[model samples]
Target: MSDSDEKPEHQKENGEINGEEEIRLKPFQPWYSVQIKGASKNGEVVMFQITTVKLEQCKEEVEVDRQYEDFEWLQHCLNIVPNVKGVIFPPLPDRPIVSAAEAEAKSRKQLGTASKNIKGDEFHKDCRKLEKYLQGIVRHEAIGKCEALSNFLTKKEPPVRAKLKKGILSNLSRAVDGVRKGGHKDIDEMFQKERDLANDMQKIAKETSLNFDTMVNSLCRISMACNHLSTALCLGMSAEDNGASAIINKLQVEFAKSIDHYGYAVDVCTANDENTLGFHLDLYSRYWLSCKEMLFERTCALVQFDNASKTLEKAKPLKKPMAEAAKEDAEKELNAISEVAKKEITKFHQQRTLDFQKSLILYAEAKVKAARDVYALLAKDVSTIKQMDVEFD
Candidate 1:
C-alpha cells in the first residue's frame, strides 16, 4: 500500500487505449488498509478500535478510537470539490441492528454486571463492514488524500459530527430541482448505454439481496428448530431404568449429538451467506444507486446549460451581455460535472467486477467448508452408534 501516482485503473505510459476512450487518472492515489479491531462502550457511545494496517505516511501502526458518528463525519466531509457532486462517494455501512436479547447482553456488560466479555454476531459483522467502508474510500485517488482521512486515522481525538438539518423548504427545493433536471436527451451513445445498464443493475442487485436475506433467515430458523429437537432427544433419559430404556437412551444421545452438529453446519451456512454473498449484494445495491445519482448530477448540469442557452437567445440587447456570461458559466460547470462523472463511473465498473469475483470465491469456499463439517459430524455419530452394545429379544 504505497501512496504512489501509479494506480491499476490508470492508463499505460503510451497513453493509447484499446479503441475505447482513455481515462486520465489523478496524479496521486493514496493506498492504505484500516481495521476495526474491536469496540468499547463509553456511556451511550460505542468507540471503535481503529488500526492502520498499512500506509507509507505512518510507517508505524497508528491506533485511534472512533465511533460510527466519527465515520459519518469523515464521509460527509469528503470534498472532491467545494461543492461535492458527480463523485461516487462510498456508502457508509448501515448501523448495527441487535435484537432485544443482544441489547440486554450489551447492557449487562456496559453496567459491569457481566463477568465475561463477549460480542454478538452483529458486532463482528458491523466491524467488518465498517472496515471495508474506510478502505474503499481511502484507496480512491482524490478522496483518499483528504486531510480529514489523515486526521481521522492519526489523531487521537474523534471528529465532531457536522450538523446539517433537512428542513421542509430544503426538501421541497430539492424535489423541485429533481423535477427540473430529470429528463435530458443525452447526445452520446456511450453514456446512454451506461445509464441504461445502471438502472438494470440497481434492480437486479436489490432483488438478489432480498433473496439472499430470505435464504439466510430460513437457514437460521432451521438451525434453531434442529437445536430444539436435539435438546428434546435427551429428555427421555429419566423415564425408566431398564435394559430397553438404556439402549433407547444411548440411541437418543447419539441422535441428539448428530442433530446438534448438523445445526452448527446450518449456522455456518447462514454466516457464510451473510458475510459474503448477502453483504455484497446489499452493498452493490446502494452503490448502483450512488452511481446513478452521479449521472443524474451530470444530467442536471446539462439542463442548466440548455436553459442558459435558451435564456441568451431571448435576452434584450442590454441584457444580452449578462445572459451570454450566464451561458459561459453554465457551460464550464457542465464540462466539470462531465469529467467528474466519467472518472467516478469508470472506477465504479472496475471495482464492481473485482468485488463480485471476490465475493463469489469466498461464498464457494464457505459452502464447501460447511458441507464437510456436517459430513464429519454425522459420520462420527454413525460410527459411535454402530459400536453401541444393545440386548435384543
Candidate 2:
C-alpha cells in the first residue's frame, strides 16, 4: 500500500513487488557438454568434428559440429572485446608446428608402424584442452556475459570482433609527452622489475619443459632396450635342466615389469608438470604483463593529472578568454580518472601477489612428488634385481 511496497513499472512483467528496480540477479550457472564426434578428411586438410550442447531451461539444446580452425577463429574473435581487456584469454592448444610429412615420418619412426589417422593421443589431449577453454570462457564474469561468446557457441558464422584503440587514454602526442614529464619513478621501477621476472620465469618454464621431454624419451628408450634384451635372452637359451632358463625368465619378467611401471610414473609426472607448472606460468606471464601495462597507464594518468593541475594554476594569471575555466574542468576530470587508475594499480598488484604465491607452492609440491615417485620406482627395481641372485659390476 505504501510507496516502499509498490513495485516499479518495469518489474511488472517479471511478477515482482519490490519498490526498487527489482533486478533479477540469477546465479552463475551454465553448462556445455563437448563430444568429439569423429575425424574426417576435408580435401588436403584433416578436421575433427566437435559437438557442443547447451543444457539450460528455455534455451535451445543445440548441436553444432566445428573444425579445429573454427575454434581457433572463435578464440581470436573473443579476445578482441574491450570489456574483457584485462583478462587473460585462455591459450589454445599448440597446433603441430612440424610439417605433415615430417610428423608422419616421426610417428612412423616412434611407433614402428605407418600412420593411419590423425586422431591419436595428441588429438584427444587437444580436444580436452579445447573443452576446458570453452568452459572457462563461459564461466568468466566479464567474458561470459559478452554476446560475442554466445554467438560463437550457437551461430554458424564467426562472431563480430571489435578492436580497442591503443595509446594512453587517447591523449595527443604533445599531451602524452607533457604527462610523461611528471611520471612517477618508484612505481615505474617496481613494475619493470616484475615484468622482467615474469619473462625470466616463462623462459625457465619453456626450457624445463624441453628437459622433461628429453628425460621421458630417454626413459622410454631404456625401457624398450631392456624389453628387447629380455626377449633375446629368453629365445637364445636351450637348457636340458630348465633351471638356468627358468631363473633367467623370471628375472627378465621382473625387470621388464619394473621398467614399464617406472616409465608410466614418469609419463604421469611429465604431464603433471606441464599442466600445473607450465600452464600456470604461461597464464601468469600474460596476467602480470597486463598488470604492468595497467601500471604504466596509471603512471600516465597521474602525470596527466599533475600536468593539468599545473596548467590550471598557470592560467589563473593569464589574460585569456575561457582558458582558465577550461583548464579547471580538465583538471577535475583528469583527477577523477587518475584516482581510478591508481586504485586499479594497487588492486592488481595485491591480487597477483597472492595468486602467484599460492600457485608456486602447488607447483613445488608437484615437483617434489615427481622426484619421490622416481626414487621409489628405482628403489623397487634395485630390490628386485638383488632378489634375482644376479651379480652386477
Q: 1-393 in candidate 2: lDDT tens per residue?
A: 766566664467555545234444554565554555555555545455556566663545555556666666666666676644334455566553235675676545443454343323355555555665676577655566566666767776544444435476666864665456424553346445644554465566556655654554454455455556656656655454356656666676676667566666656665675666555555555555444454454446545566665666666455334666666665665455445544544655575578668767876888788889878987888887886764433
Residue 243 in candidate 1 has what lDDT? 69
Colliding residue pairs in candidate 2 = none
- The top-ranked prediction according to TM-score is 1
Query: Would you give me the overall lDDT of model 1?
Result: 0.78
Clashes of 1: 0
> What would the TM-scores of all predictions be?
0.83, 0.55
After TM-score superposition, the amount by which residue 67's alpha carbon in candidate 1 deviates from its true location, in angstroms, is 1.4
Residue-by-residue lDDT tens digits, candidate 1, 293-387: 77777778887898999999999999999999999999999888777778788878898999899999999999998898889889989999999
Clash-forming residue pairs, model 1: none
The window of 10 residues in a row where model 1 has the poorest summed lDDT is: 110-119
